[model samples]
Target: MGLVGAATGPSDGRRARVRIADVALHAITRRAARRIDHIIGDSTQARRATELLKELADLLL
Candidate 1:
């Protein structure tokens, strides 16, 4: 989110520009998570995306 535009704006928390690869990685990972939720979260007792991601990250790392 703090990837573009003027260095001093409403979405400016960065002190330097970020690489396009980093931005693209974040966007792709975010969309993948949304896709997982869409595929597996159709039930009434489905888990939240945040919790599921954290769980997987904890296990993997």
Candidate 2:
């Protein structure tokens, strides 16, 4: 399996704690860096993306 697949799962299947944390950060950073144009395709999508991005920023910065 991939790094993330190895990192997450039941206790018996989980990877090292450091590996899990690294994979989690790698995932969140990639997701948080996605451009709006790459994501929003319509007004409905735009509104939802806007709200969620705002919430993410509020929680992070």
Candidate 3:
């Protein structure tokens, strides 16, 4: 859970706090990507989904 934040910074109480909104966005992006990947024989929907995922991923980066 808190592993990443704990591991990234100094042990001298300098570790950054994790933002809840960022975590939620990441989880949502992963789910959206999976949904896009699972689309079967639907080019239009798949393309739109891919575009949306790309936009969401940009926020992450």
Candidate 4:
């Protein structure tokens, strides 16, 4: 019992908070990319930004 208690000590609420933070960061990053795409008008920059967005999304899962 002691071992089990120690292993599972972190609460569900803490996990939820971390998940929310990741989601918020992902949204902010995408938004920034979109704004940069609008300003730069460069295909290469757009592609790199899109790749970054995909990577950030994969991290969420």
The most accurate candidate by lDDT is: 2
Query: Taking the tens digit of each residue's C-alpha lDDT, what string does model 3 give over 14-42?
Result: 66655446676788779877743455458
Clashes of each: 0, 0, 0, 0
| Candidate 1 lDDT by residue in tens digits, 9-35 | 447665544344568779878977764
Please report, in order, the local distance difference test score of every candidate based on alpha carbons.
0.63, 0.72, 0.67, 0.61
lDDT of 2 by residue, 1-61 (tens): 3454334356855544434457777888998898868557788999987899899999999
Worst 10 residues of 2 by lDDT: 1-10
Winning candidate number (TM-score): 4
What local lDDT does model 3 show for residue 16?
Answer: 62
Q: Indicate whether candidate 2 or candidate 4 has the larger lDDT.
A: 2
Off by over 4 Å in 4: 1-37
Model 1 alpha-carbon drift over 4 Å, by segment: 1-20, 36-61
lDDT, candidate 1, equals 0.63
The global Cα lDDT (0 to 1) of model 2 is 0.72
Candidate 3 Cα outliers beyond 4 Å, as residue runs? 1-38
For all predictions, the C-alpha RMSD in Å is: 8.5, 8.1, 6.6, 9.9
lDDT of 4: 0.61
Query: Sorted on TM-score, highest at the top, how do the candidates line up?
Result: 4, 3, 2, 1
Question: Which 10-residue span in candidate 4 carries the lowest summed lDDT?
Answer: 1-10
